[model samples]
Target: MGRTVRVIAALGLAVLPGTTAHAAAQAARPPRAVAPALTAPAAPALRRSAWTGTWEAAPSGTAPALPGAAIRNVVHLSTGGNAVRVRLSNRLGTAPLRLGAVTVALRRAAGPDAAPGTLRTATFHGAPTITVAPGRDLLTDPVPLPVRAGADLLVTVHTPDDDGPATFHRQAMQTSYVARSGAGAAQDESGAAYTATTGSWYYVTGVDVRGSATGSVAAFGDSLTDGVGATTDADRRWPDRLAEHLRVRRVGVLNAGISGNRLLRDGTGPSGLSRLDADALDRAGVRVLVVFEGINDIINTPGPTATALTDAYRTLVARAHARGIPVVGVTLTPYRGHRLFDAAREALRQQVNTFIRTGGAFDAVADADAALRDPADPQRLLPGYDQGDHLHFNDTGLLAVADTVGRVLDHRFVGRAAGVRVLR
Candidate 1:
């Protein structure tokens, strides 16, 4: 008999900022003081817990097609949060955008299972809001919030924002619709919290607690792992599915994938290497890390740059390891006949994959390529799992990626996921 151990990777997509060439040059500062020492003793054998969830905003009607601001799944917190982090996007925008008064409050309940009308309020570094420029991501200064898990929170924004045709992963977990000013979500209640408005319009994608996490995993990579082209509102992104897997086994998963992102240079989103802190490491309770990146570096960026890409990856691996957190390298999936197919690019991908397979620098490695590649085509997605784009994965494809990592983390795939503890 076979056993399943679900595994979750807190992956971030390629979130690029729309900074001007001049601004980027000026803003580039040295790596912030080697991230404060997060030295923890060998992790105890403990079960997992649902720690945090991600949320983004969807564009509303007549909302200026801000090049990078058309984000789907905006999030709001209510009732039980103190210190919260808001995700400011520049993923698809062309120029840097700035945000002003971004507020969080309780929305009125609109359903049978609604909580209460009045709820707790959140602070932006004890102020009202902070600013996030394009092509760049920012983490707000932690604020003392008082909220619990599963509470409804309202995240509001008003600013001189740029717009663009952004890409979003639609899922059913808990995303809202976006109107001009309000996110069409159930009104949040405090005393009698329950579901109210059934169908909401704001794209309030995700909201999660920051207190319940034991540790986190950063699954950084391109679209194949990011769950692109999957059903909207299904939450079928491999990371989402992985989170469910973690719930069963007692773990926390954070999704940080951006479509069209690369490891070496910028692609559709910000370069994988550049968005590390915002996407993965900087979170309060981060522990393990899984890097499933580099496909874009090989296939999309400057050709025949495998050596440079490898060197950059080495730097990334070294940085994470220096922090005492284990870094897991995932092999790149094959892209045999996509429009960007190139023999040279394919060669670079194979080289990087080879390094991941044999590179001892990584605490562990997941052979993601073997999990989804066709036995015959080898370079193309396995039959029945392709999203038809030949670049990204379908729901089935996402599951395959999850399964591969699941098995790599723990011999089991379900019932008892990675970091599981069986109580007698």
Candidate 2:
């Protein structure tokens, strides 16, 4: 008789063709298999911390004292974030600066007080008050205040001590409120306490926010970048416009422009070279630099030579590159009709612009000259864009410059944000 064949199936079962005993024996036997070990999922990569400068003004020097008063500064934010911090500068103060209290809030349409229920107090190292030494800057503790892009923020500071010669940004463009001689106005919600208005920003230099932006672009220049001719309280400065344009992307714009600032020597403020660290590289999350200066050095008192200007440009580029920040050079706009402009100055401007355009020293170029120059006379600004003084740009001209810069930055950064970090 043929022996009955039994086969073990892949399902751990024994198949018996003709014997019931085999089936019973297979069913009685225990299976010899072990369960596979499970592993904890790999830890997720740590999220990088990024700080974007939502609003900024280059500190020039001290303004009239705000002795024992509460000052409310209205600032326009370029980008929004989940949290916020304020940067107060005593960079030009001759005495110790005492901040009794500081608060930040979202404004309600040009008003002195913040929007109802949006006020948040700021602290330093967990303290409600802090003192900043002369020539120093202090950053407040992060406040959980969600902000929107292009929103207005009111930063109110109460100084109980005599803040002699208040360190300030002379051309704020936006109006701020001062409670001449009062405290606790910072916590006022009705704006009834604020009585005086001023165009300059005192003590407060920058507003930074914790964000996910790829980086920030520092606009380094002079009066033009400072929005000299732009309409007051309009936020029409070229850098402001550029910041508005960049709202959709992951970038921030910091205007480090000081009126009458020079590139090689001190004038209205510290020279561009001297302040580069504090104004550009040291700013939180700065990844790209836009150099629109040197025009003052070429046209103002003690004007520098074209060679000197270009050499400075080279140095600026080198310095930025050393920090892995790409530098973009903006060609100087025309100034043929200004009192300081002459054939020699115009020639020097052309030479410096040529170097900016073709020198290959900068990572990129923004042809602001071509964008604002009159078609009929390339050496002069277009009448429609000029602010009557050929040296400065009106609202329309500022918009044009902003558009050109936006295009350049968008092309180089928006879609290729990863590449921006890799730029040397």
Candidate 3:
């Protein structure tokens, strides 16, 4: 039974111990010992949350920008911890990228309908000045950033020099910026601070919030997952959309995608098989994972035999399962044109899809093929959803993907809530 206590502020009468006298008994007995005062529990100690998120920028050498394109999409991360670490990327840049200044701050919301709050103040985890070579990424030093989860974390970067096309994602999933008033504006103002000004290269790659070592989700995949053709400044990629979904559910989504990334040999970007440690398996407290990849492996150059590709996928599955993380296999979407389609590629794709769908290795499967494929011609991608390359999905198409996955995930979340399932 639980304990209960009641306090009386003022009582005029008190029952007598022996007789029924009230006033006489009140002045007779010794006063009872006053109880000790209660105090509130202490706040949790400052600690970094294992930050895991991906880079979002428009990659150059693509078609025109889509609707809602911007200079950057700033993601005010849910902060919690003593120190913070930021991951910046030039993964899609064609040349070297430079940074004028970078900073983090406490954000202030302009209004309820507006973005999160503006930066009340900030601190740097490393030198404000840094540079990233083309096709590379940078991780900032562990800076003391005392914050709690659900708090806003503002990051800003400026590029004075850039070369090549200055690689960027088409539509990013998270928010990033190109700088307007240095890197420390009280609020991220509307309108880009920088124009499409000619320069060497500039882009924000990744950011993480570390608060105690726990809970992370790897946003694993290829160009689509990498936000290849999303939009400059506008973080509207599928993975970002997925991240948004996860955010509502209070789950962390770490994007581990590299543009043109394949599950087999190096193709558009890094291969998935080789980057597992750095991408997914290495993060702390990562309890769940989503593997939405293998399209490039099935369709890219120097194509592998069906047997080889099958073997590669099986290996990836085994590796993931070995770590005890529940892996959700996402089917490779339809890619029938834009120059990379072939009979051999089709065979490999089919074999890989078969494995993804039927393989008992995966904890669950996300059928992107069904979501994006044409109902009339299931093998071909649905019209309007395709980015016209037959390889990637447009923003609408990406949203469709997230919606489908979210639909599937809904059941899992509901089951867990109902005590029918458990995620450990």
Candidate 4:
């Protein structure tokens, strides 16, 4: 009874106004315990992504200036990634090229219009604009836009000042739009402001994706690889067909072909030897190189001899080997009726083709000749394959070339990356 009375007295002191009474009651009470702080759960590890080349156009040369105009280049991609980025070149520019705005968006029905919500403004090191120096190039910072394979994307470049000799790919074989008024129409989602069309690609050269693609295959060659005879806007280039075939492998195909390109020396663009590094070996995730050159060299006079050509092939292979990249030697295809065809040229072409097939100078060979040649004539393109030029191949012929490459690559490098080469 006395203890209960003491407890009641202590409770009464706690309620009292005086600090002395409160202190006495507090001192009499047991100590309170502290609760442990709550800990946050650990975060999951981020998935790693690699930059892969899904689409590319090697800069061929320069075009006239397009000052204060926004040029929208429509590019068809081979593969896709989680995010996207683009490469613009000034490789042939005589002066600095200043870009006011660089934007990308999904195309709406093959026009300059962007899909409802896919426009993305690309920055250069966090700045929305960039100035590329002469004989130089720039890559945009990655945009957080998920892209898909086989998408037709619009990469628009707004040049505030004269930006030419604009680094360009001469034979785009696809339609692109231009807004001749000013830079304000660059990011415009509607196609209203774009009133002009072109058959070449300017400023933008390559499209890279942040995704799981292992690497890319570069189709380095001439008009055959550049789709000279294939229908424009149809994506019927042999390289394009090759991309569709490569979709399952999660690999990309980059067409580095320039129409009239040659093997030993420069003509339409830099010779295969001159541009190999930039066009193939140094490209993003380039695991293999497929050279489909030599046709123009054979057609054009002052051409290399069979020995000189094969020796050049040896040099190209050696250089590619230096970079740990294997080379594939494609046999030179037949050209019997073209204006430049002659007995000597035909014999020389035969010698080169023979070497390509058995010289063992390359890591692998994709016999575009066997696939494109007339079994009946052996010295001419199969009639259906020929684009009436006896040299260039039509869409069906492009598919044939693509199939030949696909077959050899599949056999030699299925589930892996090996070199590829094509002859046209």
Candidate 5:
């Protein structure tokens, strides 16, 4: 038997300042499950305020499973809290994924060393060990710890036996460690046992913290949002930069980007339309959704038209509004020298960007194209920001994109989102 794991990417769209971009047509597909505009969920329980997303890496694809081997994923946080919890998924597994041990702790330095007195074992349903069924998600009970935002945390997982494909997020950009022995060393705080290193995040999907921040912002899109061009372990992805800006305000940012992903169909993980809820809308304390994608859709084979892409944006926005979560759209940036660049595709990109800016589909707009494009030639990426790939941005380019996003989701936007409604 076989299963298909959808690769979801972000759409390159934008919202006008306190105004809606209007598009009248069946451009967008029929609302699968559209949410009302500017509505947040009703009065909530303690759990509602108990957890806010600090970090995330959307599962991009599966890899061969490693039984009896322990995996330690080094992750960075956007915000910290009093208590923390981890979420693991087997959504793409063909068989049950067994956990022998799981641990979370603050990092002492870089490598795999855990800070003293901070290592904590994770439990599911009060049990230290449990089986995560295929196509399912499980959350570890919250551990009481002082989690500092902008810090690194080590989430280590050990499997006693191989089950099926290992659900993982590729392009972690950060290095992780693996222990080949049955000891897994998952319970060890020392780095000596973890002799091997890997670039992808395994099993572990998200990290959430309780207290400190009231809500978070989800950065949804493609490789640009995923930090493809950023330095390893530097946390300089545009989303990471945005998180730094939001830190002072106590807001978290989640980066959910799938490289080579598209908005209309699955290529890397799941299509853009299929991942909105998991990547953004449904996340803990998610108040805003910002998207920057669609280059793949335009440059890839048999790409989507401006109309098709815009309709998809409208559908995504409608669903977000129904849940009372405000959507912020970002225009696509320039990519002139890329291998896939072409005149027709470039024209399509421009058309889609126009709709994103003036189509009345979003609540706020960030002109990423204008911010990162060369004034001498609007079609080309600014020389300072180019990651050398023309398509992706370097650290400087990442910062530029971050500035564009922050300019729109500024204090005024944050204030309005807070009072508009609670997210459902």
Candidate 6:
């Protein structure tokens, strides 16, 4: 009845003496036919939805205006994507700021010019040009520019109107190019027209890219986090180094540090508490915060106590937790030999660090003090890491701090879906 039995009967093979009837029948049957192979389905296309902050510089103060001139700012991106957008600020400008043109391109090197065939023009609401009012920021429409992590982007803006007081980040260690009024170099691929160089970033504040990343981490601190003592044009800041360490991971590192920034009151820039929302929380896809402030408040300012500073830290932690982003507290480094160092300030620094280490207030602790402090003279920085200022770290010190932070982040976030609230 079955196919095998029919084949065996038709073949007429004799049954062996030792073999069973089923085995003899199967041996006489013809081979079975094989089924045809199947084709696999094509993979679905990925959707472009999430965006991350690839590069950022918190606007600290106002820079001189570039009336009828083109200014090009070079920024280092922490993550790459298929499309890019830029955030420009007139936060300190007195009058409306008008722009004639705006362009973004991938830089071939550290200089002003972009690589050929990689330049792209950015638009705002489908318009080529826009006017930004005082105390406001404008985000350009997404431009199709493929970028790799750690790529340097040259953003050129042509200002036709007199921008009164340009909102800027004053401590950009990297050099940027500028063309005078008569020299229009916004679209120049060869950087020949850019004659002047500056160390500040004007107008542009942040750059966001569409990518598959979990989110970004904002380094909220003062000059040490701002890369003050690192060499010019070298992306050796602790946050820059952290970005490099996290390039293969799905995370972005944004440097929101302002030189001389204080945690308690306004100083070189807005206080850490005042600008936390704008600088850290509101950034594109920011998931974590790292606070390395309070040194300036303890040494340079008055009316700050250990209790007050730790209370301020508590406030920062609470605020970030409300937005579902964890905060990592960094222990302040030693500054015993600096001009501002005093017994009272050193005592306060020790008290605050004790609380940071044992109080269980922050979600994580980076222990920067232990990493950079001298073993012989615990109240001062290690001789090799010190930049001679006693307060800031050199390139080597910066790398050490970055490595510690990177390890902490990796242990907390990588390969884990749920966020961890506390890390020693």
Highest lDDT scorer = 5
User: Native-vs-model 1 lDDT?
Assistant: 0.49
TM-scores of the candidates in the order shown? 0.66, 0.86, 0.63, 0.86, 0.88, 0.86
**Window of ten residues with lowest summed lDDT in model 4:** 34-43
Per TM-score, the best of the predicted structures is 5
Better of 2 and 5 by lDDT: 5
lDDT of 6 by residue, 1-424 (tens): 1212111142232211111232233223332221111111111222235788888898888977888888889999988888899988776678888878889999987687789998887877677787776766667888999888888999998888776888899999999988885235787787878889989998888999996655778999999999999989989999999998887665679999999998878667777766776677668787778899999999975659787788788777766665566777899999889999999999999999998877777767889999999999999999899988898889999998999888877776555343422111
On TM-score, the stronger of 4 and 5 is 5
lDDT of candidate 3 over 337-424, digit per residue (tens): 7687877777777877887787555656788988899898777889878888887888888888888776655554322333323223
Candidate 5: where are CA atoms >4 Å away? 1-29, 32-49, 182-184, 416-424
**Could you tell me which residue pairs clash in candidate 2?**
none
Task: Give the range where candidate 1 is weakest over 10 consecutive residues by summed lDDT.
Answer: 1-10
Q: Which stretches of candidate 4 lie over 4 Å from their true place?
A: 1-48, 416-424
Runs in model 6 deviating more than 4 A are: 1-48, 416-424
- Provide the global lDDT of candidate 4 against the true structure: 0.77
lDDT of each: 0.49, 0.78, 0.52, 0.77, 0.80, 0.78
TM-score of 5: 0.88
Q: Give the Cα-based TM-score of candidate 4 against the true structure.
A: 0.86
Q: Lowest summed-lDDT stretch of 10 residues in model 6?
A: 34-43
- Model 2 reaches what TM-score against the true structure? 0.86
